[model samples]
Target: MARPAAKARVPKHLVALAVVAILGLVLVADYLWASSSASSSAVWSSRLNLHTGPAGSTPPVAKKIKEDKKSVGSTGINATFADLPAPELKWEEMAEAPVARLDGAAIQIKNLLYVFAGYGTINHVHSHVDIYNFSDNTWGGRFDMPEDMAHSHLGMVTDGRFIYVVTGQYGPQCRGPTTRNFVLDTETKEWRGMPPLPVPRYAPATQLWRGRLHVMGGSKEDRHEPALEHWSLAVKDGKALEKEWRSEKPIPRGGPHRACVVANDKLLVIGGQEGDFMAKPGSPIFKCVRRSEVVYSNVYMLDDGTTWKELPPMPKPDSHIEFAWVNVNNSLVIAGGTTDKHPITKKMVLVGEVFRFNLGTLEWSVIGRLPFRIKTTLVGYWDGWLYFTSGQRDKGPKDPSPKKVKWVALGTVCHCHRCVVCLFF
Candidate 1:
């Protein structure tokens, strides 16, 4: 065989060089992976802190995140909050609102909370905005809304600078809703009109998602039938790009007072009722006739922006929680609201449990209990605290008295899905 075709002499130094090159590549890959993991952990920690505070405002506790990880597992302390029991919330009373009202809209712009128009009393409805300063802990700067704006049951959403107010009951009591829509420039404090809703709705679920203003699922003009119609309008700079609203897929169920939220880039409508009180015509056109209501715990999600998918239901039936929600870490915490009628009394019962919905796990849990039962509670999260104000109190459904008292949730809103070593080290 010609002595294996004169086999080439293998150089020992060359073989050693090849081995070193392979080892070096392996080491490099390991280092890259470690660095990548560290970056991911840091980014996640920062996001967690962001949700607990206002935009661009970092709390002092965030600086200790690194040190906290080091002490997480040293004393057998649990690092993963995924399995941690829900913390009992203790509420601290804060400054009362400028006025007592229900069915209003509230949005947070940095440290300021703007409370919009709502039902004041039987024939009275507020047509002004009350600004609450979270930093100074005071309610100041009261301004009037648009002259023709709907007072109660108005669907409202804020794009940080502009507050968009949509279809709502024009007057107090069982009055019909107006299709008129308006947008408020928080900077100039000027109100401009937007395209009217194709169909008038009462307390329609309104949100800004993916550069479109979405409004859906509320009582129809009858103020009793659920409006399944879904509509969206391309909007920019507080102005509607399209001439009219474009209709989308109908909701699985149509109802008013549902909690509509955009979390994790998904649209969620949770816990509402099909039927509502109707206006009885008489000497007093504003008289509201009580109607049978069917409270539900059904939770629906829209992820593809086209189809509606049902997700896990709430722990119990809830409604009038349209604004009683705050974004926590990977979850949504809702405050007090009305629930289904009591079994024994056969009367409407207000919700007291503060429920949490985990977006990651798609589950619901009673995270804590509110200090008292209330409905139409306006919620806001700031500086590691959950705040709620201006809602109808625990009195019977017949009582329309609204409260101005505000409360701050005192407890850690922590839910971790990763361990200390896995997330940090």
Candidate 2:
């Protein structure tokens, strides 16, 4: 009887309230613990500064990037090649060109390298054509282009069998442009006439895509008039000698000395000088004329042939005028051209930097610097090597003397698992 009396009845509502209060207290404690733990974890992470490398690779606890002393160009942009993955490039001296020339075009067909018309040592344009045989490593089989077809700044392209030479200047001294177009059969070594361009131009970029020849921006008849028009020509039959040129949509902006190449099935127009070069007034030297030209860092891409869309600008704002560009493994590799922004003085100098743009990532990085600054050089990609023909080195205004070059620099592209290694001497 005494034990039963001790059990006093509790209210149901009070019991329910007690249970709710306990649950609320438990949640509050959990929230506070979580907040404090998260804050401490973040603080520790910041202080630790952990870095993770590629899977299965050990990452350094700390990294110190060394500054590169070499300057990029007159642009004053400096970059270090230490952090960048090395490109697959090996450079060596090949056989010297049979002749030294500038402002010309070169194309590789099979094992033969065709060097077209260009200005020689005396600054006189020559119609000389020289073929270099890779099999024998010799330059021979010289041919004279027709008097009419002999021109510089011509847009030349090859379809693996025939070389198509398009619009160009008639002479070396900034003469009027020529509309004449010709095709040379590599098999027969015979030249034949093709349909002339709708608009005559010089230094236009020509490339073969989808069995059609695409001719892009260049200067008009007058060196001052930039050709904004674009045209394409197709040979109905592979063996046909005659073809019709059709005009496509024009480029939004025109530029002379633009470099064009097809990479990843996209037609890319690289940097070029926009404005016309004019003589500077009150200059002491004859060639001391100041250029009104604006160097472009813009890049445009044409995928449909009817529309051109601008892509990311170059890393630097220097013009690629008279530069050499090649498509290596779907990446755009540009090298050797003057900034061309300033006059021929200490400020005006050739760009010794080499830039490579990855089409997949749309990123550009300075790969390496040229052994010597060069401009208006001929660059050809054959097998796994990039061949740089003769080019002039600018000694600046004090000297204003053109340096002679005869050796052909061969850059052999070495393929690594995830990176390219470019070795140059």
Candidate 3:
């Protein structure tokens, strides 16, 4: 009788209400557990993002990554300043150049420097060729270029053994721009002619890359008018073949005296002066004419030879007629150029600042300054050293003084650690 009384049915509404209450309690517990888990994950993420390095010191790998991302697009290649240290340059005075000259081209091959024609004393251009032997630190071998091929403000490049000299001013003080091309055999000390450039130009940057010769950025017959045309000459049978100068994409803008170098299989054109070089009033070359020299700091790179991509500009506007630049490891080291102008000093001042451009990042940084100002000098890189020889200091344009520097400054580029050891121990 008691079991039957307990089994009496409860109200349907009350039973449904009890079930809903139990479900609400379960839902509240689940939300609390999820919120706690989310908060713990947030704390973990915050800790991960707080990773820091030593005060005032860069984490080498992380810094490299950041620089690469900023300079070049994501290249997936990591480089550190520690491994490829900023070039430690040391200037040591060596034997003087045989002759004082400017606006010449020089190349280093097998511990020897072959300096080509440039302007000599009395503002006269000469065809004199001199050689500097590193083994003895002496300038001995002396030769003259062919009377016809001898010219200053020419574009020159070397493919290890052969030095290719391209178009340049003919004579009469940088008047005639010739299309003549020639090659010199270093071992035999012989010179041979090659196919001429399609159009005559002077001060165009020339380089040999992947069996082709690239010529870019120079002036036409008039030294002032910049040429925007670009041309390439192919090589066959280990020699620059005689063929038509194949036209390629023009530069973004034309300029004169732009520094050209082949680094990382890419062609880079550095700062130069824009516009034409009009003759100034009372000038010896072309008197009573207005001359406008516009300097630039822009940089452009041509990787495929069909398109030019603008890169980070130089730190300052520079149009040093004769400056030295070379590809050192992954950097383009530029040294000893006048700032903002070519004449360097109407007031007798020149720039000794040295800078380096990182190829991976396409970024430029000041490495160090030269001991003294140099312009119109031939710079040569050999065996981890840069040679700055026979350049002019800040002499007034009309000074007529011996503008050519006699001292040969050797900049031994070493790693930072090696430089430190040399300085201390």
Candidate 4:
């Protein structure tokens, strides 16, 4: 039975204030959700499987995966690059990941991509390791982490041969071995210990910039999101710098960690919940705001800590927009993500929508759509297309199976992971 609205109230003024507080929280949450939509999942903290082909069209031969060394165009798919009606990934019974998991971030160490640490049903955070070889299309494994680290929303980046993972939260209320930075060597398959972060935090902006691993602008918990406060770990013999912590010009009105990538020799941060950050992340929880602050898409780039300039915002603020290149020969492509309140449902743990960003023009557009409503999302880019996995993918109206099950390459990898290295020359 439903309680009557009038009789249930404890006090008048208190009720009103509570309502206002609720509204404020909802509004800010909405704003954050609106401004950012994750291409990847953010449970710890957050691409589309975009193929370089016309809708219902076929793929061409000789595809190239864009890494720091190469630049390609969307050749056979569409030279002009027109957005296609979204397609729900076809869920297949035979082609699922050998193992099932979520909250794991994939870091590419040279030709091999490793999905490190994830959260599962209960105590599902395993040091389990899955290795994929793009050249041979093989899935193998080495040893697991020395200890289990299973928070989804951590920050990570690779410098040529090694992956530097830092600042993730585990249990409730942002608990941890906070301040943990794990460095994995691809050749030895060994974990080297680095100095812990200055504080315990998750979702910090991590990237390989100017040959140093830049770890900056992240939050600890409910309170305190750090500023420009940049710290770089200089690589020695492919190892991290002597001192883990250093400082840089802090971003003024610091905000929550948005999408951080090395772009054009500069540190580029994009949309997130708070507008304070020059850059931000994509979120769907803040949908109404997405509808309201329609023009909140801004790309903030910092050059050597001296310049903070805003490149054109997205045509509109599109959250949960994933990034990839349409084909081996294509420009950078941003695809898949939804515009809806998260916890979309306990049964459905993710959002579903497909959008793309143009690296060349700083524009945003909707291309293909998800086949089914999805939750727990990730778009893994390898070879020429992306392998959308672990997520519940929408197949379409007539054939909807919420769970996306596969290791198939639905699309291509982006222009070298959002930052450019340009072997394109």
Candidate 5:
């Protein structure tokens, strides 16, 4: 039977082919397929950006994003800033204004900067406010303030149209009255009184949070010092004057700090004069000792009133710094305040220097120094540029010349971290 099966005739080509030849062809194909697959997998992985999406089904699930809302910047920098709010710095030397101020209150609505209640000589605060238009770089004399507020650490907020000037101190003469809140309508250019602050408050850094105006620690009614009490003012009329003062969670430290901003649903308070000694005349007694700067390099973040997490403070110790005078794009910029104190210096007061902090990165870098001394005031930013209206240009007699608004582009703002890369490749 075996001999009969082997007797079948085979073609010449088939008889010449060895089993090894067939096996070799199979091996070559398998090797090529595997090599190609491995290379393709690596290439595809480089190109693949797979974010987990909903499972394949009629109803889908929403993917959870870890990032908070306030921290979102332009996705790729090419997106339109249509709905984004852009602030512009405009100087008003064209018109007749008395003194350049640092402690003034600025509010924005419809791209107009309404300035009020700044520091100057003889209790003079341009009662007649100035309105600046960033679009045309023009100034219009608007409504006059009913009262003069001097040396009052002021906090300001605008509810789309109306702006409210919140708690600040009067001066260091004696104990000052706990000032009531003043609200103004940017559109109508009128001022009215809002609900009284729950406590004697002043100079707290104020900012808008999730559609609500929040005021943080600052110099209170006692004197040129910041009180730790934090209060939030909410406006129901969409007008600042009609809002009510409701006490919110206080910062862990019960003393006024210079500036505060909202990030990650938490309030970040910068620095203030804390625990610095001062020498006085006619006696051996020292006053306002530890006038802050104790925690100059300290940073405090509050997730809630009950919990305050400490982040790295500024690399440098500057107290009572002008939070508004420094401009940072999507970051917080603050100008000089204090470093150290001596008989020659009351508290280390620095001018013209600027420091910027990125909440996302927790990074601090000195951005730029002003061309002229910008003594103090709130800083505003627009389109990666900085602008500030100085209270006093320097420690000297106020220049009678019409005050000029100063501005510096962030790229031109300074040399450090100021990137100048030409993209022509």
Candidate 6:
């Protein structure tokens, strides 16, 4: 009789509570599933829209992400100061560039470093000149470049007050360079036309040597064949004294993207490539077409501005280092650039090692390395620190992934206020 006693009736309120708990669990599970799917499908923009200025300053406008539709490559990895080849050196981060760009030019005038025209994207070019004040470690005013100025592949140099910008790709990617050249007066912030190049070149070796603007050895208009052509213009006070560029002795090795500098009153051309990336002839958009290129370690120096003497070569072949050098203790300190191609992948490999070519010894040595492998880095030196910014960073060794970066990296080369010991190379 006791076993047969009716099963205890479950409490109605308890049954109702159990049903509600089950419903809640199902809803939460559904929400999590939907969120997971959405996150997996989202795509990230390539360019970062950062607020750039003195640290802690409020942004004038709301931040926005710029998605490069044409940037359809792998999102590469990042590198830091810890990755530098020199263990004794330390890197300090500085103000972000006013605009992220590559293949631009940077020149120091007094305590200010002026960064001008370059490619914002393959199809987007920037015409703004941003000034960074090293005196205060702040990004100061920005001005507009000449509207018609070429944006990328520019050959730029400064003579105390005037900055000369020479021939380069005028518009979007792979477009032919303009014959037009320009000069900007830092004091006036005004740009005026200079004598155009006789043959439009891409990233020619340009430097102010002995009161003449010497330009030599850049890719021809087609952006394929190297031009051995050499030309010079007498320039003074932000103006070209001559109507046209005078012809000079041609370079022995013709190429683009070379670092041209004046060291010990000698005009030196170092590290460049024979060919460059061209545009696909028939593509609707100006799509970049990679062609065969030869990276060389050849070092040519013009001792008397006429005869170019062959000097000791770089430790490795390098290119795209047009502005990646600074004079440190009478030595030429060169930074990251594109070097030889990967044997297996056949893609261009990037160089991270910092090289020093001693003018006194005529020797080459590796002093340090960049945070990462990069090309087209604009460089400057102030107060015993080597500062570089704005370039295309590669993924890693043998990985040629194109990673857009806006990092302002500074490495201490000598005794630092931070009390770091100098590791002389």
Which 10 successive residues of model 6 have the least lDDT summed? 414-423
User: lDDT of all the models against the reference?
Assistant: 0.71, 0.60, 0.60, 0.45, 0.47, 0.71
Residue by residue across 299-361, what tens digits does model 5's lDDT show?
788775567788877756555553453323346667545444322333333433456677667
Question: What lDDT tens digits, residue by residue, belong to model 1 across residues 1-425?
Answer: 46556778899999999999999999888756643432232212312222333344433232323322111111111232111233333334556465667677888888788888876655677889988776556788999887788998989888899888998988877888899999989999998999999989998999999999999999998898988999999988889899899988889999999889999888889999989888786637767877889999999989997888999888778899888887777788887788766554555666656687878888887655544456787877666556677665543222212222221110111000011110111
TM-scores of all predicted structures: 0.74, 0.68, 0.68, 0.59, 0.59, 0.75
lDDT of 4 by residue, 1-425 (tens): 99767755487899899999999999888645532332222111002233443322111222232222122222122223212344323221112244544445566654566765554432334466677664555567746865634355567776656767776755322234367677777777787777777766555667777767777665544323444466777765456666657766665434443556665577776643332111112432211121111112456788866767887654333332222122222333433332212122222122333445555566665543433334334444443334444432333232122322221112111111111111110
For residues 181-278, what per-residue lDDT tens digits would candidate 3 score against the true structure?
A: 88888778788888888888878878787788888888777677888988889974337665688888889888677788788788888887766544
Ranking by lDDT: 6, 1, 3, 2, 5, 4
Q: How far is candidate 2 from the true structure (C-alpha RMSD, Å)?
A: 23.9
Total backbone collisions for each predicted model: 0, 12, 2, 59, 28, 0
- What is the clash tally of candidate 2? 12
lDDT of 6 by residue, 280-314 (tens): 98877767788999999999988875687899999
lDDT, candidate 2, 103-191, per-residue tens: 76778777677888776632366697888765545688998897898467788777778888887877644556778888888777788
State the RMSD for candidate 5: 25.1
lDDT of 4: 0.45
The reply for model 4, stretches above 4 Å from the true place, is: 1-94, 135-137, 148-150, 171-174, 223-229, 252-257, 274-296, 315-330, 338-351, 373-376, 391-425
Candidate achieving higher TM-score, 1 or 5:
1
State in Å the error of residue 407, model 6: 12
Q: What C-alpha lDDT, on a 0 to 100 scale, does residue 200 get in candidate 6?
A: 92
Q: What residue pairs clash in candidate 1, if any at all?
A: none
The Cα error of candidate 1 at residue 374, in Å, is 0.5
In model 6, the clashing pairs are: none
In the predicted model 3, the residue pairs found to clash are 224-276, 224-277
